[model samples]
Target: MSGGVDSAVAAARAVEAGHEVVGVHLALSRAGGTLRTGSRGCCTIEDAMDARRVADRLGIPFYVWDFSERFRDDVIEDFVSEYRAGRTPNPCMRCNERIKFAALLERALELGFDAVCTGHYAILRDGENGLELHRSSEEAKDQSYVLGVLTADQLAHCLFPLGETPSKALVRAEAEARGLAVASKPDSYDICFIPDGDTRGWLAEKVGTAPGEIVDRSGAVVGSHDGAHAFTVGQRKGLRLGVPAPDGKPRFVLEVRPVSNTVVVGPREALAIAELAGARFTWAGTAPDAPHEEFACDVQVRAHADPVPAVAVVRDGELVIRPDEPLHGVAPGQTAVVYAGTRVLGQCTIDRTVSAVPAAV
Candidate 1:
């Protein structure tokens, strides 16, 4: 339990189902004493206490596992490295992939646990092929995108008790009925490590600023930024470019070349991506047999973003996604989750993209 209402209620439901359940809260960082200024952080001391209280109420043993070092190496360092490589990464997905499912699940299994349960809002079903991951009944709260990196073996030993829970309010109501104190706890919305949500500031402290030139699509220097790492593809607001485009149209960040410390800005249309190629692909269940070279599926590039119809193919050791329609702002290092309707097929880390706009000679 993350010391939240949903997880508390999930524990309750799991216990009610007549299964022996123990609550395990992960201590992800050394900043345990840090106060949660807003409802956008997890693993704080307050959250741990809340989780302990819920475990007490549920009559289950609770333990706080310290995984700070592993988290820093896998998730935090990965975040920094991806940004330094001029790519935007979803650290939450990395946390789910590396820490929660891999590290915690392995530990739980060694302790004779049949499965690791969490409060994620995704459905697990036994399909003909094997176990399948599906979106939650609550569409708005669906988290299958983040969990898409799990392999078939991982999905087999996982349980999500809140997948069918109609809504967040219902989970809170269940928590209240069970006399849980965290029924009204605000949901965490920001990156857990960056509690204050000042990503740029936090990154700047870790990766020192390097002055860089901001050039337009035509290779003309339009402005300058403190660092290319501070910007991301599809970003528009913070460019602070002093010059306007010749066509008098607003420009967007088209690319971040960290090697040369250059930020490329251009017309918004330049951000449109017609296809994407991803490496490190993982299937949630069994990889389906492809009679042909390509198959049809829905691809979601970001959490909470709508999945777009696409054609998928594995060629040259990369999962290639060709969206039926153009997708904008697809950056390297972001996850591209594939799904067939509501069933999550798998996901891969985007390595590159094919822009819709032709390159200038």
Candidate 2:
């Protein structure tokens, strides 16, 4: 259990299902707590203690595994590097794919456990032949986006106990009835390592002071920013630009050119995107065997963001996605997840926006 309400209820469900369950909190960190003390993050010792308490209340065994070093090297460091490369990174997905399900699951299976169970809001079913990944009854809290990277073999070896319950209400009732301490804890949605959701501050801390320029589409120097690391694609407010468009309207950030230390600010219409090129795609429920089959799906470029209709063509290992309805503000280094209804088909890391939407939209 991750020392949270959902996981607590998940544990209760497992116990009700008559399955022996053990709760383990992963100890992963780098600079310090993954989030502020009260915020949602696994790095805090308090979260570990919370997981232990859940184990105690549930009458199950609990242990804390120290994987801090590995987490830093694999997740945090990679997050920093991806931002530096002008790409947004999904550290949570990385943690799930690397530490939790990959490393910890393997260790658990090696220790003779039948499977490693999690509180993820996705269904696992006994299909015609084996376990299948399905949409959770709880659509709002469906975390199938991050878990989409798992392989079929991995799904066969895993268990998700809270798949059928809608998260915000049903999960709460389950936890409250059980009298668990974390029954009402609010869910965390920001980056774990960056408290206050300030990724620019974290990048500044790691990359030192690298100055950059802010210019318009015509390459006119409009403003000078502190550092290119402090900006991202589609950003607007902090551009510190004193310039206005011909219509006397405010401008927004259009690009972050790290190589030349430039932050481009322009009209909001410049942010629309129609196509995107991504690499390192991993499909979950099913893998599209060919390019024609792959591109025939809708995709999401960010979490909690709407999934626009799209098609994918997997060239070699890279999947290039073209959205049917123009998607605005497509950013590099962000994840583009594809889905069909509630089922997660696959996802890829964004490389660049090739076809963008019309500015008016």
Candidate 3:
């Protein structure tokens, strides 16, 4: 349980189903005093206590597993390194891939658990091929994009009770009916470790600031930044450009070149991405029969972003995707989840992007 309404209700349903259920709250951070400010963050001391209360009400075992060290090494460090490499990573994806499903699920199976159930809004159906991951019944609460990293083996041992639920309101009502204390708890948002929601400030402390040039597409120096790591693709504010654009239009961050220590800025149109590819990729259940052949699919770059019609192919040991419509604000290190309708095909950590617009002279 996450000390949230969804998980509490999920636990309740699991218990009602007559299965022995254990609620395990992961202590992802070693900080004991970590507290949720409104709904800004999660996995804190208060969240654990709330989870325990829910477990107590359900009359099931509850344990707070300390996964802080592993989380720091995997998710936190990976976030820092990706930022240093000038790529915008989704830490939630990493946590789900490495910590939640990998580390937690591994330990759960060893302890004789049949499955690791959670409150994630995603569906798992027994398809013709095998078990397949799909989007939730409620489109608004769908989270299959983040769970795309789960392999066939992992998906087999997972259960998501809230996947078929019509709405979050129902989950909250169910929790309240069950007398769970977290029924009215607000949902957590943003990165859990960075409770304050100041990502730039948090990254600055980890990646020390360095003077770097901000250049336009034509190789003209437009501004300077404290650190190239602080900026991301499509960011429009805080450039502090000494020289304004010739057309006086606002310039956006087009790229962050860590090797050159340069922040590339240009017009908003330059943010359109024609192509993106990554070497590191995984299938949700089973690999496509023709892995090297081009396939029609929809590519979702961000968690809440709309999926775009695309053609994907595996060539030269990389998953190359070309969206029919150009994608804006796409950056390396961001995960691109491929979907065929509601079914999650797989995902890849974007290693590179090709701009749709030509460079300005």
Give me the runs in candidate 1 sitting further than 4 Å from their true place. Answer: none
| lDDT by residue for model 3 (172-277), tens | 8888888888888989999999989999999999999999899988888978889999998889988999999998999999889999999989999999999999
lDDT of 2 by residue, 1-361 (tens): 7777777887888888899888888777644434444564444666777778888998998888888888888898998888777666788888888888888888888998887888888887665544456668866777777787787777877888878776568778778888888877777657766656767777889976676778887888887877887777777676677666667777777677778878877776777777787777776745655655555777887666777787788775578887877787777878888876666777777887863534332
TM-scores for candidates 1 onward, in order: 0.98, 0.92, 0.99
Error of 2 at 321 (Å): 1.2
Model 1 scores a C-alpha lDDT of: 0.91
Residue-by-residue lDDT tens digits, candidate 1, 15-88:
99999999999998886477676797888888999999999999999999999999999999999999999999
By TM-score, the candidates rank as: 3, 1, 2
Worst 10 residues of 1 by lDDT: 284-293
TM-score of 3: 0.99
- Would you list the C-alpha lDDT of every candidate in the order shown? 0.91, 0.75, 0.93
Q: What is the lDDT of residue 233 in candidate 3?
A: 88
